[model samples]
Target chain A: MNKPASLVVLDLAILIDMYGDDSADTICPALSRFRSEASKYINQLQHAVVQQDHAEIARLTHSLKSMAGLIGACQLMEWSQLVEQAAKQRDQTMLANHLPELTTIWAALQTELASSLLLYGSADA
Target chain B: MTLTRNIHVLVVDDVILMCDFLYGVVNKVAGCRAIKALDGKAAAEYLGNERIDLLITDIEMKAPSGLELAQRVRSGMFSQTPYDIPIIIFSGNAYREVIEQSIAFDVNDFLVKPITSAGLTAKIQYHLQHKKVLKPMSHYAQLVADVDYAKAIELPTEDRAFSVAIVRELPEPKADDVDQREAASKAKEKKEKKEFLVWPEHATTGYFQLDRRMRNFAFNVSCFHNVFVENCKPVAIESERKRACEAADYLFHISKNIKQKDNRRDFWLLFQQRLDKLQPHVKELNSINIKHHSQVLVLLKRLAYWWMQTCSRPLIQINEVTHETADE
Candidate 1:
C-alpha cells in the first residue's frame, strides 16, 4: 500500500510518544474518546456557524484547539486557531468557509484512529 | 543563596492530559515537586493550602482563569505572601490579546504549549533564582531615602531577602498638557501607592547638576513603561523609544548610583521583559514608516546593551566593595 502523505495523516509514532504507546492501554482509548466527542464538537460548530453565533464558534473552536494540541493534531489545532481568530473578529464569511473542514478532519481522524485501535486490539488478543 | 532542597510548583490546566504532561515535566527537575490542578478553582484551593513556591498555569480554565489567578497573586488577594509569587502562563493559545492580558496581569513569564522539559525548567529556575535575590522596595527606597549608599553597598555576611520591593510603586510624573487627557483615560486606578526611589534632602550623586538629570531619566523611563504597557498606547512609540535611549545614556553617566545603591538584580529582569515587550508595540506603530521602525529597532538594540551593562557590571563593584572590606 502507498504511504499516506506525511502532513495530512496522523503520525502514529508521535501519537504513541505523546499519548504513551499505540496499545489499548494508551493511544487506543484516547483516540476512542476523541472520536466519540469530535462529532459533537463538529455538530456544535456547524450549528454555531449556521446561527452566526460568533461567541459560540469561538468557544467551540477554543476547546477543539486545546484538545487538538494535546493529541498532537497540528492541522486541526491550527485550523481551529484560524477559525477562532475569525470568530473573535466576527468575520462571518471566514467562519462559514472553514466550518466544513472541521467535519472533514473529524471524519478522517476517526477512521484512522479506529483502524489503529483495531490493529492494536487484535495484536493484544 | 540558600534554597529549600525541594521547590514546590503547582501546574494548573483544565485538561487532564495537559496537566499530567506538565506535572511530569516539572517533576523531572531533580529537586522539584510538582502538583496538578485540573481547573482554576482547584488551583486556588491548592494555593490556599499548599506552600507552592511557583505557579505554572493555563489561561483558559474554568472561572477565575489563570490570568485572574495571576492578578490575584499580584494584588495580594490570596494573602499568601507580601512578595509576588512568580507566575508562568503556559497556554496553547498565545493570541495577541492573551499576551496583553498576561502582561497587564503581571505574569513573570509566558510560555506557549508543547514546551520542552528543558525550556520549562529553565524559566522556572530563572524566576525562582531571581526571587531569592530581590528585596522589598522599602529596603532600597529606605536606603536611598536616607542617602546611605555606604550601607546599601555593604556585602552582608548573611544573605538578605530584600532589595527593590516598590519597583511598581513609582508615581506618574506630572503629564504634559497634550498627555493629560490620554493619561487620565489610560490610567489604571491605583489602590495604594508608595514612593519607590526617594532622594534625601540635599542629596547629590557627587555631581550636583547630574542628580537632576538622573532623577528625570529614571522617572521618564518609568513613566514611559507605565504609559506604553499599561495604557496601551503605541502612537507614542517614537518619543518613548527616544526616552529609552536617553535613559540608557543617563544610566551610563550616573552608573555609580545604580551600581552602588541598587542591590537587587530583579529590576533588570523586568527591564529585559519591558525591552522585549516593546516588539509588539513597535509592530503596532502602523502610522510610522519602515525607516522609523528600523531606527527604533537599532536604538532598542543599543539600549539593551546599555541596560545589560548597567545591571551586570554592578557585580564587579560589589566584588570591589567586598575586597575593600576584606582588606580593612
Candidate 2:
C-alpha cells in the first residue's frame, strides 16, 4: 500500500503527545484495536441504517464519533457527528445521503491506520 | 495529602477501546493503578472487593448507568468501600438532562468526553488530593425525585419558557464589611478540623484479644451507622444492628477482665454503661420502625465517639506509666 504524501485521515501527534516518546509501542496496539472496533461499529451502523433503526444508528454513530475524536480522526469524527445528529432528529433523507460518504471516510481511515500500524511494527497487523 | 498506598482508579465504559485508552492513561501516572470495567455491573463488582480510590465512568450504559453507579456508591450500597468515593462522569455529549442528572447524583465532577491525557491526569491528581464530602442520603433521594418529576411533566413549549424576575438588588459590601468577611473566613478555617472516629494506631490496647474485639465492635457500629444513614432495607439494618450488639456485648464482657487504675476504671465503667444503653436500641430494632431510626442513629453516633475515646485509654495509661517512671 502506498502511503499518502500527506496523511489526512489519522493524525497521531495527539497520541504521541499523550503517551510521550515511547508512544509507538502503545499507539500501535491501540491503532490495531481501533481498526477492529471501528470496523465492527461501522458495519453495525450500516445495518442499522438499512433497517431504519434510528436509535441504533444514533448509538453506533455516537460511539464512532467518540472513538474517532479520541484518536484525532478529524474527518471521520465530523462525519460521525453529522450522522449521529441526523439519526437523533430522525432524518432518514439526510442519513441516506451521508451514509456513503461516511463509509468512504471510514475506509480511508482504516487504510491510514493499517499503514501507520505497519510503520509502528504492529505484530497483529 | 499524599496517599500512602497506590491510587486505584476504576474506569468503566461500555466501549472497549475507550476503556483501554483510559486504562493506559491512568497507568502513565506514577503511583496510580487503573482497573477497567466494561460496564457498570463489572465496575460495581470491582468496587465491592477492591480498594478503589476514584471512579471515572461513562454516563450512558446498559442497565445501571453511570449515574446509577454513583447513586449506589453515595447510598452506601457497596459495603466494602466508603460511600463518599469521588466519582467523575464523562461522556461525549454533555446534554442539559445529563448534566442535571449528574448533579442530582452528587458526582464529584463531570467531563465532556474526547478526554485528553493531560486533562484526565489533572482531574485524577486533583481528586486524589481532595476527598469528596457526601451529602445526606435524603438530599440525594430528593434530588433524584425532583429530576424524575421534572422529566415526567413536560409543559408546552410556550409554558416551558420563563424569565427570572429579580425582586431586589443587594448593595455592594462596604470596606469594613469586607474586612469582617475576611476575618470570619479565617476564623471558620481555623475552626475546621478532621475528626478521627477510630485511630487504629492509638486504639491498640496491649491485650490482643481486647484490641481485636474493639476493632470488630467499631466495624459493626460503622456498618450499622452507614446502613441506617442510607435508609437501607429493614433486613440490612436488623442484620447490622444484631452484629453490632453481639460485638459490643463481647467487648464489654472482655473489658471486665482487664485491671485498670482507679481513674481509668471510671472510664471503663462509663464505656460499659454506654454499651449497656445500646442494648435497648438493639432490642427495639428487632421490631424496627421508621420512628426509631433517628433515635437509634443518634445513640450509635454517641456510642461510636465514646468507643474511640475508650480505645485511646490504653495509650493514656502507657503515657502515665512512663511519666511515673521518669519521676522515680
Candidate 3:
C-alpha cells in the first residue's frame, strides 16, 4: 500500500508543539476556522485589487500575513507581507504582478492544511 | 492546606487564529484561565467588567490600537481592573518606534511576534509572578495633563520665536475678528485633541503626587526658558522664575506628605535625596541675573533634566520572589 502524502506548505509540527501531543482536538477545528477566514480574505483581496483600493488591500494583506504566520505558513506569510508592502506603497504594478502567485500559494496551503487535519483527526480516532 | 487562585490572563488580537493560538498556549499553563478578545474594543469590554490579572495584546489592530488600550488601562479608564495591571505588548515588527511608544505608554513589557510556545509561556509566567511598581492614578493623570499642555504650548519649529512673538504682540481685535478667531481656535483645538495619551519618559516620576508637583515645576521652568530666550522684560522673567520657585516649594511640601512603608519607604528616601540635590539649582535660578541669560537657561535645563532622570529611575527593585509566594 502507498504511504499518505506529507504536508508541504503547512507546518503541523508548530501546532502540535503548541497544543501538545494530543492536539488533534484543538488543531482540526482551528485549521477549519483558518481555512474559512483565509477564503474570505482572499476574496476581499481580489475585490480590492480589482477596485485598486490600496488601503483595503494593505489591511487585508496585513491580516492575512499575521494569520498565515500564526499557522507556520512561512511562504504564504512572506507573500502576504510583500503584497501588503506593495499595497502600502501604492505600487499597482507590483501588486497586480504578485497577487496571482500569492493566491496560488494560498490554494496549495488550504489543501495541505486540510489533509493534515484529516490525518491527525483519523489518527486520534 | 494552601489555597490557590486561578490567574486570569486577557489575550487580545484582531485575528481569530492568532487569538485562538494564544488562548491554547495560555490554557495549557496550570492555574491559568485564558480569556480571548478578538479586538481592542472587545478587550476593553472584558477589561472594564472582568477580573483580568494580566493583558497580552497585539500592537496592530483595526482600531483602538494596543498602545491605546494600554494607555486607557494605565490611566484607570477601566472600572474593574487595577490601573497598574501588567500589560505585555507583542508585535510582528518590534521596531524601534514601537518599542519607544510602548515604553512611553508605560506597558510592563514588550515581545516580538512569531513567539514560540515556550517563549510565550515563560513570559506569561514571569509577568504573572511579578507585579510592576506604578504611580498612583492621580500622579499619572497629572503627568498626562502636563504633557498635553507642554505639547500645546510648543511653538512651531520654523522661526518659532519670531512667530510666537508676532502672535503675542498682536493688537486687540475688532468684535467681528474676535468671533472669527474664536471659531478658528475652537476648530483647531478640536482637531488637536489626541486619540490617546502619551506620557514622556522624562516627565514621569513613578509617584502620584511627586510626579504632579514635578511636572508643574517643569512647566514653570519651561515658561521661564521661553521668556528668557525671547528676551522678555526683566519683570516677566522674574515672574516666571518666582512661579518656578513656588512649584519647587510645593514639590518639597508634597514629598514630606507621602506616607510610605517597606519598598515604598526606600523609594521615598531616594526621592528626598534627589530633591536635596535639586533644591540648590532652584535657589540658583532665583539669584541668576537676567543679563546672563545663558547661565539662567543652563541652570533651568540642568534641573529639568535631573528631575526627569530621578523620576524615570526604577523605584522598586524586583526581588527573586518565588511563584509560590506570589500566589499567596
- TM-score of predicted model 2? 0.57
Residue B73: error of model 1 in Å?
0.8
Instruction: Kindly report which residue stretches of model 1 are placed more than 4 angstroms away from their true locations once superposed.
Output: A1-6, A12-40, A43-47, A118-125, B1-6, B95-101, B104-106, B125-328
- Across residues B2-111, which tens digit of lDDT does each residue of candidate 3 receive? 11568788999988888888898888877888999999999999999987888999987766778778877887888998888889888654333345556665778776
lDDT values of the candidates?
0.54, 0.64, 0.64
Query: What DockQ would candidate 3 receive versus the native complex?
Result: 0.12
RMSD for each model, in Å, please?
Answer: 19.5, 26.4, 22.3
lDDT of 1 by residue, B1-49 (tens): 4346788889998766567667876887767899999889988888877
Q: Write the per-residue lDDT of candidate 1 for residues A2-67, one digit (tens) a residue.
A: 001112344454455454435667666566655556567778888887888887787777777666
Residue pairs that clash (backbone atoms under 3 angstroms), model 1:
B135-B162, B135-B163, B136-B165, B137-B164, B137-B165, B137-B166
State in Å the error of residue B85, model 2.
0.8
lDDT of 3 by residue, A16-122 (tens): 54445446667777678788888888898889888988888878887887777566565576677667656655666867777878656877887788678778763
Q: Candidate 1: lDDT of B48?
A: 74
